[model samples]
Target chain A: MTESTNTPVIVLRGLKKHFGVGDAEQYALDGVDLTINKGEFVTIMGPSGSGKTTLLNVLGLLDTSIEGDYQLEGRAVNTLSKRQLARIRSRQIGFVFQSFNLINRLTVIENVALPLTYKGGLSHIKRLKKASEMLATFHLNEREYFLPYQLSGGQTQRVAIARALVNNPSIILADEPTGNLDSRASHIIMEELSDLHQRGNTIIMVTHNPDLTTYASRVITMLDGKIASDTDSLLGQPSVEFKRPLAMVVRPSTDNQAANSQTKPVVTTLSKVDRRKLKVAVRKRQQIAKNRAPARHAEEYHQ
Target chain B: MSRFLLSSHLQNARHSLRSNRSRTLLTILGIAIGVASITTIMSLGDGASQVVAQQISNLGGNLAIVRPGPSRTNFLTDITVPQGQNYATSTLTDSDVAAISALPHVKEIAPISVINSTITGQHSAPAGTPIVSTTPALSSVDGLQLDVGQFLDSNISQNTAVVGSNLARIIFGTTDALGQTAYIRGYNFTIIGVLKPLNQPINYNNIDFDNAIIIGQDIGRQLSNGSAQIQQINIRSDSAANLTSVVSSINKTLSAQHFGDKDFTVLANSDISQPTSELFYAVVGVTTSIAAISLFVGGIGIMNIMLVSVAERTREIGIRKAIGAHTTDIVWQFLIESLALSLSGGFLGYIAGYGLAFMISTALPFYPSFNWQIAAVSFGLSVLIGTIFGLYPAVRAARKDPIEALRYYS
Candidate 1:
C-alpha cells in the first residue's frame, strides 16, 4: 500500500488450489508464495503437471477457488465479483497464449480491437485508429485485414501482442508464447518481449524451455506444485542500465559537488544544463510516460 | 454481456447456416411441410362446413320433410323396410297426412308415396327416375309452380299425370307435352301437367325430381296391387309464426295414433339442421387434431436441432459467460431464434392453406369455402408450439458451465 518504488505489481501469499474434494482431490497449486515488481520480466519455468497453468489461471482471476490472498497494484483481488473481475482483467491484464487465441472469423485489426469494442465508450474511428497504431508498431500493418488462419505463427503472435497492447494494459501474462513457433520465429518473439520489458512494461511469462529464460530478468522455477528455485539474472543482470550520457553525467555530479569547491563551476554549469535538461527531460518523460502508462497497466492475466 | 458479442453470435449463426446450406434447407423444409399440412387441413375443414351451411339455407324455410324414422338414429337400420313387414307395416300412412292437415295452424298436408318404378313414353325417360304418387295438395306443400300444365286432379277418374320439367323434357322433348301419354311400369298415363325446374336435387331422402313421373295417390295404389304405402307426409305451416305450434300438434297426433310409442317425429327448420351442423363440427375437430400433431413434430425438430447447435457452440457460450453474459440473455437468444423460425413458417403456411382451400372449393363439388378464423388459430398454434418446445433447449444452453464450456473444442 505504501508509495514505494519496489511495490510489487503482483503478490500471492500461501496460495493453495485443489481440483477435487477428499480422496479424489488433486493439488494444482499448493502453498505457493511469489511476488513480481514493476518493470521486471519474470518467466515461470516448469515441466507439465507442475501447476504452471493453474497458478496462471489463479493470477488471471479466471479461476477463484484457491485459498490465498492476491494483491494486484496493492488491491485485494479475491473478493471482487465476476463482473468486477472481468473489468479488472480487461483493463489491467494482457494475455499472449501459445495458441494465439485470435478469433479466426475476425480480421487482425478487429481481433486486436475486441476488448475496446466490448468496452464501448470510445468512437469506432478512434478505436480503429488505436488498433492500427498498435498493429503498425509490430510491423503488422500489411496483415491488419487478414484473419488468424491467413497469418503465419510468428505474424499471429505479433498480432496477439498488438492486441495485448491495444488496451494499453499494465502487465502481459504470456503462457509459452514461443512454444508453437520455429527457432527463428521464437527468437523474434523473445526479442519483442525483451524490447517491451526494456520499455518499462512488466511481463510474466510461463514457458517450459529454459533457453527462453535468457530474455527474462528473473526466472521462477516450479516442481511438484512448488517453487523450486527463484533464479534472478538467469540470462544476465536486469537491463535497466542507463544509456543516455546526460543521465550518466548527472549521477556523478550529485556526489562530486558535495566533495570539492574546485569542481564548483563544472558542477554549477552542469547543474544549470541539468536543470534546463531536466525540464526538457521531465516534459519528454511525461509525454512518453503518458503514452506508455496505459499499456503498462492494461495487462492483468489471461487463461 | 456486450452488444458486440451478441452481434458476433448472430454473425456466427448466419455463417453456420450458410456453411451448411443443404442441411439448413432440409430442416426448413421439414418444418414447412408440418406447417403447411396443419394449415391446409384446418382451413379446408372450416371452409367445407361453411359451404354446407350456405347450401342448407338456400332451401325454403317453410319446407318440412318427414322420413320413416321418429328420430334419425341409424337411417339404414331403423328405416329400411323388412321383407315380411314391407307390405302390411306402414310407418307413415295417408290417414296421418289427413290428421296433420286438420291440425290448427296447418296450411296443407301432402301425402307422398314414392317407389322406384321404370317409366316409358314416346320419348324414353332417363334411367332411375323416381315414380311419385300424391294428391293435388303436394304442389303447395313443396312450393312447386307449374312450368306449363296443371297438376293432377282430386279424383283419379282418368290416367292423367303431372311431371317435373326435366322429366317432361325427356318424355316429350318440349313443354308441349300436355295430354301426352307417359308409360309407367307398362301402365299408360296421360301427362296433363309439367312442373317448373328446381335446380337442386332433393337431398334429405335422396330423391331426384328431374326424372320423376307423378300421378294421383289412389291410382298409384291401384297399380301396385293396393300395397303402396305413403313414405312421408309433407306439411306446410300457415306462416313462419305458426311453425312451432304446428310441429307440436303434429307430434302429439302422430304419438297418439302410434299407441303412445312416438314412432313418428315432427321437426321445425332449426331442429332439422342441428345434426348436419354437428357433423360439420365433428369433421373440423378431427382434421384440426391431425394438423396439431404435425405442428408438434415440427416443434420437436426445432428443439432437437437447437440442442445440437448449443452443443456445437459450447466454447462460444463459455466465452460470452466469461465476458459477463447473464443466463437470461443466453436463453433469450436461443428462444428468439426458434420463435423466428416457427412464426415465419406459420405465416407462409397460412397463405398456403388458404390457397389450398380455395382450390379445393373450386375442384370438388361438395368442398367448403375458406374461413379466416381457422387460419388465425393455426398461426397462433404454430407460435405456441415453437415457444413450448424451444424452452428446454434454451435453458440447457443458458445453464452451461463457463469453464467446462470454454474447454470444449469442435
Candidate 2:
C-alpha cells in the first residue's frame, strides 16, 4: 500500500531540557525544532553525549521539563498532566530501548504483550491472540515461551519491537535499537523496520551508525544537544505502491431486464492485455478520488 | 501503571529479602530473643506469686498474727509468765488475750509462750527446738489438729506435754509418743499427746513446730522461773470474709493499747500476699522492657535492611515511577515489607517465648501462667516500632528522583 500524505504525527517547537540549576545547570536538549510526518521512516544520528537518547525520551514522553511546545497528533503534550501524558504515551507512542528493557521474569510472549496489558482495551483471549500474531510476524512463535535471558540479543529486540507494535501506536520511537546487535542482526532488524515502513507505519530511530540512514526516509543529525541538519532521501523510495482494481468487470446475464440495469455495453473492442492496463488506470483514478473525499468534505465544512 | 508499580514493588521486595536471607534470619532472631526474655520473666513472676498465695492459703486464710514493735513484747515474750525472755513479754499477758477475745469478729485469741529447750529421747535432735507453752486455744486458732492423743488442757496438773507429729516421729519412732516421758532442759515431762503435722514451718517468730515440745500455758510459765511473757498473739476471725475488718480492728485496739504509738505490727493474709504479687509485676515490667528493646533492635534492623534494599533497587524504583507509581505507592511498598518482616518475627518470637517459658517453668520451682494480653501488647508494640522506624527510610525511597534513579547503574 502507498503511504498517505497525512500531516506530521509529531511536532516539537523550540524544545529545551536542562539539568541542575544556576552555574551547575547543563543543557540536555537545547532549543530543538523537529517534525516527523506520518508513515515516514526517520533516523536521528548523534554521538554519545549529543542528546539523541534525551530527545527520544522527550518524544516518547518518558521525560518532560523543556522550554518548548510538543504536539503529538495536534495535542500539546507539555501542558498535559502526568496521567494524561501516560495515557498519551501508552496509546500513541511506542518505545524500543537499546538494552531491550524486557522484564526478565516475563516470557517472550508476555513481554511482547506488555503494552496491550497496560492499555487494557481487549479481552485476555483476544490479547493473547494478537500477541501471538505479532510474535509470529517477528518469527518468534516458537520462542514465545522462553524468558528474555534465554533468547539471543536479536530475538530479544524482535520481542521488543513486537511489544512496541502491540498497541498500534501512531509513532514508534527507538533509541539505539541496533546498538547491541552485530552487523547481521542489525540488517535483520533494519529489514523488519523497512517492512514496517513499507506498510505505512511511522518509525523514529536514533542511531550513531551513518550507514543505517539509507533505511530511513529522513535523517536528522544532532550536535551539542541541538539539531544540526535534517535531510530527506532523494531516491530511496518506499517499497509498497497502492493501486485499486477497476470495478467495471461485466458478466452476461440470462434476464435481459436485470442485465440492462447491472451491466453496460462494451463500446470498443480491445486486447486482453490492453483491457487490463485500462482497468489499472481507472482503478488508480478511483483510489485518488476516494482518498480526496475526506479533504473535500472538510473543506466544504470550512466554507 | 498502578498495577505495574504494585507488582514491581512486591517483586523487588521478595527479591531483596531472598537475596539476603542471612540478614533477615538474624533480624528475626533478635526480635525472638527479645520476646522470649520478656515472656519467661513474666511467666516466672506469675508462677512465684501463685505459689506464695497457695502457701499462705494453706497456712490459714483467716489467721492474723500480732507481734510487738521495737519496744514491747507480746504473750510469747512475757517474762512474768516464767518463760523469761523466751516468752514475749507480760506486756501481752492473759488480760490482753481476754481483751482481744472480747473484741468483735474475734473467734479465739491464743497467746503462745515459746522457749528454747533441749529434749533427750531415743535420739538427740537439733538445738533450738521450739518448746511452745500455750492454752487449748492454740489448737483451734492455729488449726493444728492432733494426730494422736489429745491436746493439752489448761486444768491438767500432771506436767504432761504434747509433741508435734514430726518431733514425735523423730524422737519416739511413731506418733504414739503417748505415755512417754521426755526430758526437757533437765525437767521430766510426760508426752501425753502428739500434735498434727503442719506442712509449712512457722515463720512469724522464727519458730519451727516440727521440733517443738508443747505444754499447757500456765504450767509452762510456772516451770520457767515465772517470767512468762507472750511472744505472739494468734487471732482467728469468726469468718473468712471478715479477715480484713478483724485485722483493722485488732490493729486499732493494739495501737490504742500501745498509747497510740502504733508499736505493734498486725499482719493478715493479704499483707503476706503483697510481696509475691509485687515481685511478679516487677518481673513482668522488666521482661516487657527487655522484649521491647529487642523489638526495637529488630525494627531498626528492618529499617537498615530496607534502606539498603532501596538503594539496591534505585533503578527499579525509577522505572516504576516512570510507569506511573505515585509516591504513596512506593511508601506503602516499603512499609508493607518492613511490617511483614517484623510481624512474622513477632509471631515466631511469641511461639518461641511460650516454649521457653514452658520449659523453664517445668524445670524450676515456678509455674508459668501465660497472658494473652502480654502477647497482644508485644505484637502491637512490634508493629508500631516497625512502622515508626521504617517511615524515614520508606519516605526516602519514595522521594527519590526518578530521573536520577533511572540513571543509576548500580
Q: Mark the regions of model 1 whose C-alpha exceeds 4 Å error after superposition.
A: A1-11, A35-41, A71-78, A83-94, A103-147, A161-171, A191-202, A231-303, B1-6, B45-287, B318-355, B364-403
lDDT string for model 2 (A8-42, tens) is 78899999999899999999899888877788887
Question: Cα deviation in Å at residue B32, candidate 2?
Answer: 3.3
What is the per-residue lDDT of model 2 for residues B1-410, given as tens digits with 9 covering 90 to 100?
Answer: 35554554465456556667898788767766776676666566556555556655876698887755543244223211222244335456566567678889988877887776687778765676778888788777766778778887766754888887888888778878888878876777888778777644423433556668888787777767775667778888988889889888877777676677765667777554322222334445556667767877877788888888789778766655544455676687788777767776777877787788888767555567677776875588568866887788889998887667777777
True contacts kept of 2: 0.05
The TM-score between candidate 1 and the true structure equals 0.56
Could you give candidate 1's per-residue lDDT for residues B1-410 as a string of tens digits?
A: 45654664455456555555665555555456666766666555544444434434454566565545557555333223221123345587766777777888887777777766777777777765778888788776666678887888876555889888887777788767888888877778988788777653523323455568888888888877786677667777777777777877888888887778766666666544422323334544555555666677777877887788788778766655543455666686777666656775677777776676667657544453455666677667667876898789889998887667767888
* Predicted complex 1: DockQ: 0.10
